[model samples]
Target chain A: MSVSVQREDFDVGLEYARFVAGRTDVGGVALFVGQVRAESGQVAAMTLEHYPGMTERQIDAIAAEARARWALDACRVIHRYGRLVPGDRIVLVMTAASHRQAALESCHFLIDWLKTKAPFWKYEESETGARWVEAKETDDQAAQRWRR
Target chain B: MKILYFAWLKTKTGLGEEDVPQLPAGVTNVGQLIDWLAGRGGGFAEAFANRGLVRAAVNQDYAQPDTPIRAGDEIAFFPPVTGGVG
Candidate 1:
């Protein structure tokens, strides 16, 4: 598994190759890219803030857990830090497995776990100034689905 | 110890981060920490005055109001989270 938190943009093609470096039995690869939505609750732009050391560790741990739970051949998670505008890419998750089910399941697990587990905070700057958005109870409940 | 704030909480605190004294006695939990911080008066009280609107994390992990905190732990107070998934 590979995890990175950087300001520079990432290439999905390059990242995908690195993920399946020497694997020939990889029959499926599931990918997820999260972009800063321009229309979330009528917000203009969103700024993402995170703790340096803590954020990376939390993401890596979640990825590891997903790998352990499924028969994944490779897993990759990347999240960008610093200020970001609407429509900008925020994060990406890719998982590879011999079967489609494992790959897809791992991808779902990665996203759900990151939502509730990672140490990231976002504040939307709008006409009403900035407000620290609340973590919805729905997110917690969504993550609970993988707690087998 | 360092106290960090995020989003609107940071604006209300008029600070994004601050160096604070070590944890005081009887302030080992999130509720106690808020009560102690409320004594700072003004903005501190306003930012954390509403228990339901506030959320906390100890050492970078989501912690409940009853979560025990230790000295030197990085305590962060914010108005919950609103970031992207995956």
Candidate 2:
């Protein structure tokens, strides 16, 4: 039921604990955390830029859609912008439901949609220079299956 | 109308935003607008050379090629969403 877009890092353990704290109706919680990758030491850092107004709107809508489609008691989505290095957390999606099925599916759905739907673009700084990360066909295909 | 660019499009245009009070002749939709800009030559032309690589939104909502355009609205052009951690 909450979506946060920030330039700061987040703690996975802290977030997970806060998300399900005192929630008696929740039987299971599914979590997905995305962190910056080293990519064989080729990438030094990543800068994420987003449409200031549209990024939050799109993320909130994505979270809402997941809640509407799945039987979930609560959900949390957090995405970080600005510059980040390897090992830094980039995103988190958690879903809590009375059963594991809804929790797992909704968590997966949120992660997929956040990647394709959110208006954030990544710029990778490497040894040679910096370049915008290319969109992947596989990512599109992953999101496409949710439509069916 | 306000036109905003993002990512590589922003870099190619050498601009983040441009204000055009009126659409050029025959520019009545998103597709036509892109064509008009692409025909401008130089940076604009290069940015839009590959039609399939460009994506857009009208008034902050996802827009299609045939989406109607009118004065006083905002339009943004960018590449596909970078699908990764975020």
Candidate 3:
């Protein structure tokens, strides 16, 4: 299990290779990458800020929950903070398991829970000015599905 | 106790973190601390003007409104999380 919150970008291929390397029990690998979108077309940049200590702790806890819920061989979560432009990668979630179902489901669970439970905030720079992004009710609803 | 702010809250308060030797009387929980912070006026009032918008954490963990607080505790306040798959 690994969780990293850093400003540096990561290579998907390298991470995936490292995750499954020497793990003969792994049969499936599920990976998800999130990138900054040009939502309004006017967004020039997006800055991500987080509570340093809390961000890592929360993400690690979430990963632990995923491991408990699924028989995952390995799980990796990488979230980048600092200024990013549209098309830049923002986050990555990868899970390896003995079966496809466990790998896929755990990957999904990690992303969903991280959405609302994590302490990161986003600020967007647009033509008008830079402003804090508002939390969407949709995100809350998405996270609610995991309660069961 | 240490109070920390993030994102816009930090910008508004002009402080990222501060050490409070003592919490005011009657401020024994996250909610009450917020109310007490508002009482400090100025940037604090503006930052916490909308209670629903502020989110709190106790010792780097997500904290509820009624979460108990005490001396030597590290408390953080910020806006709701906007992080998702992206």
The numbered model that scores best in lDDT is 3
Expressed as tens digits, the lDDT of each residue in A21-59 for candidate 2 is 888999999999999999989999989888878888888
**Model 3 segments more than 4 A misplaced:** none
Q: Lowest-scoring 10 consecutive residues by lDDT in candidate 1 chain A?
A: A38-47
Candidate 2's C-alpha lDDT? 0.90
User: What lDDT is obtained when candidate 3 is compared to the true structure?
Assistant: 0.92
Q: Score the docking of each candidate (DockQ).
A: 0.50, 0.62, 0.78
- Please give, as one word, the docking class of candidate 3: medium
lDDT of model 3, residue B56: 93
TM-score of chain B of each: 0.88, 0.95, 0.94
- What lDDT does candidate 2 reach at residue B9? 98
Which predicted model would earn the best DockQ? Answer: 3
Top-scoring candidate (TM-score): 3
lDDT per residue, candidate 3, B17-63, as tens digits? 99999978988999999999888899999999999999999999989
User: Which residue segments of model 2 deviate by more than 4 Å?
Assistant: none
* Model 1 CA deviation exceeding 4 Å by range: A40-43, A126-131
DockQ, candidate 3, comes to 0.78
lDDT of 3 by residue, A1-148 (tens): 9999999999999998898888899999999999999976988998999889899999999999999999998999999999999999999999999999999988988898899999989999999899999999888887888887
Tell me model 1's lDDT, rounded to 2 decimals.
Answer: 0.82
